[model samples]
Target: MYVAVKGGERAIEASYRLLDAARRGDPAVPELQVGQLQQQMRLLVDRVMAEASLHDPELAALALKQAQGDAIEAVFLLRAYRSTLPRFGYGEPLDTARMRASRRICAVFKDVPGGQVLGATHDYTQRLLDFGLLCPDAGHAVIQAASGAPVPDAMPSALAALAAEGLIEPQRPSAGDPEPPDITRVPPSYPLPRTARLQMLARGDEGWVLGMAYSTQRGYANTHPFAGEVRVGHVPVEIVPDELGFPIEIGEVELTECQMINQFTGSADVAPQFTRGYGLAFGRSERKTMAVSLVDRVMRADEFGEDRTSPSQDQEFVLPHSDNVEASGFVQHLKLPHYVTFESELQLIRALREAWDARTTVPPRSVEPSTKEVCAK
Candidate 1:
């Protein structure tokens, strides 16, 4: 279960040097700045931040640079860096309803409260590569330009309307406003509460989440999810000081949230109402947001009396395996020396083979004719 890796100090140091050179490819070319990575590779930074559960964009960009653009490796670097930092007090739950939305869309309703603002999305753009991006001035490369319009002060959730009609399931908090368990602070056990589960999903690997969510679409869990609403915006992060005894806005972080509406059972099967799932992540991650939302709905199969027919539906299966850091460490550990364990296996196999040969090759003791039979012959 553990790697008993042994190596020479010289060899390890040499390997480290080689890795440094590999990370800094082609020194003759202009080195990439942290600012350039922050602007150009914004999505990469976002993914690292989400996976690492760290909010700093600059560090995320630096981690990506250090890891040579490997998202999982960048996440590992970021998480390692995060472990050293001191913990401040927790922030108040962001009121996403009052968020300054840059993009908002809802598949359930065509005419939402604020209308569908496409924002800076490539959804409508042509798939062809624009070679104009290679030029010094890449500003004009896009098919459409930003209108430079101000977003509304707040965009009400599309779910609000559905809730008013009593067609949607309620997600009201319980009494006493209990503090949610932080996975970083507490070791998780299965059958986690919604809050802890949501926190884990927020930091889960994007690729794995997408695969799990896609399984539901392909008739595995079959939630029949619609994009109830997907909002991308920046929300203020507030901290309540012990002395002050009131929350104050420290800063803001960009977040992408998805509220997926699923129609699992019809009127014949159950009451004709829609179930809702929530997903929130750091920065403008649409696919991750949608996937997390879909998976979240499937995870609630027990509450809604839906059958647990897929891996995604099982929280035990999903949450424990979704962390890329843990998964990557485990898989990569195979590269380490397992010579002692492997040698034992080899010896066992050889002994078994030798025993088989001895059993098969030994001539059956010649049936010695009984004395009477020999005499008769």
Candidate 2:
């Protein structure tokens, strides 16, 4: 009398259709355009671009739309698309000093050459919900501020300035001609190259990186880092055309750079020098950059004369676990069929229980005569 199961494929297709319909919503209510998302959902777009390691905002918006506004899924989509893009050539190392900065600040200095520009930030706004915005009759008002001031020339990067004065540690170009490990092509190893570390942090999940960074602050490690500089802006990416042999301005990318200064308690006979920590990521991601910079500082414990006793200070611990793609895939795969392993464990439990029951229920064998008594007999 059991009803027959039917229409598995049809049901799945119908479900997909329903999902699509839901994603699109009513035709009367104009569809959410990519541009709308880019302009309005800027933070979400920025996050997707950052995690995807791709700087194209339009592609991020498309991924966002296709993912139905799921940020992680959007990043996955963008990452998948980015993989298909052909690698033309490597660009010159980005010059943070040349960035057309949207926002720039230095915690160490209050009156640097380029005064702190807190441009387009949500930092000062009240967190209270605005019920008025929900009203259909809500109207917008415009306020005026002084305008028309000339955009200032790009200022010297804070790190460069510090290095110039010999107050902070300087990063020497990689010694000898050792080949740098490419994270995209090879699995990262212990004592990872700086390039690999940077790649992992740049594409790492924001929340995960932040949590690891937070652990350091919560006494997991002996890191006292000051945010020396945090800047977000569009920097031009130049490439040398193969045929032309001269560098050509390919395009511009939005980027966030964070530089941190850590105290160096040098070992005996070693001169104390200020240690540097650096983080650079694709797209505007100040939070990720700051978190990564802190992590970078924590990871430099051995080099900077601190003990590497905590997980945060271990390079292998941080880089391998940073990728959301790898983490999510492994986690979600557990949801699939695992009945075989479960059945095996169940059989073992049953056998163990039966053995225990048999041993306990059997009356103790009558004690045999002592060996000494038997021998005497």
Candidate 1: give the clashing pairs.
none
Off by over 4 Å in 2: 1-8, 25-29, 135-148, 159-161, 177-179, 268-270, 359-377
Best by lDDT: 1
Worst 10 residues of 1 by lDDT: 1-10
Tell me how many clashing residue pairs each candidate has: 0, 0
lDDT of 1 by residue, 162-192 (tens): 8899788777883466789999989998888
Q: Name the lDDT of candidate 2.
A: 0.81
Q: What TM-score would every model get versus the actual structure? A: 0.90, 0.86
Model 2 lDDT per residue over 1-377, tens place: 12124665676679799989989989798799999899778888999998888888888999999889988889888888988999866887777678888788898887777778887777788999888878753533422443444546576676667788777887775567466666777877788767678788878999989999899888898777898989888888888877998888878888889998987866786567678778998766888899998888887666655778888877777887888888887897786557678899999999999999998897768888999999999
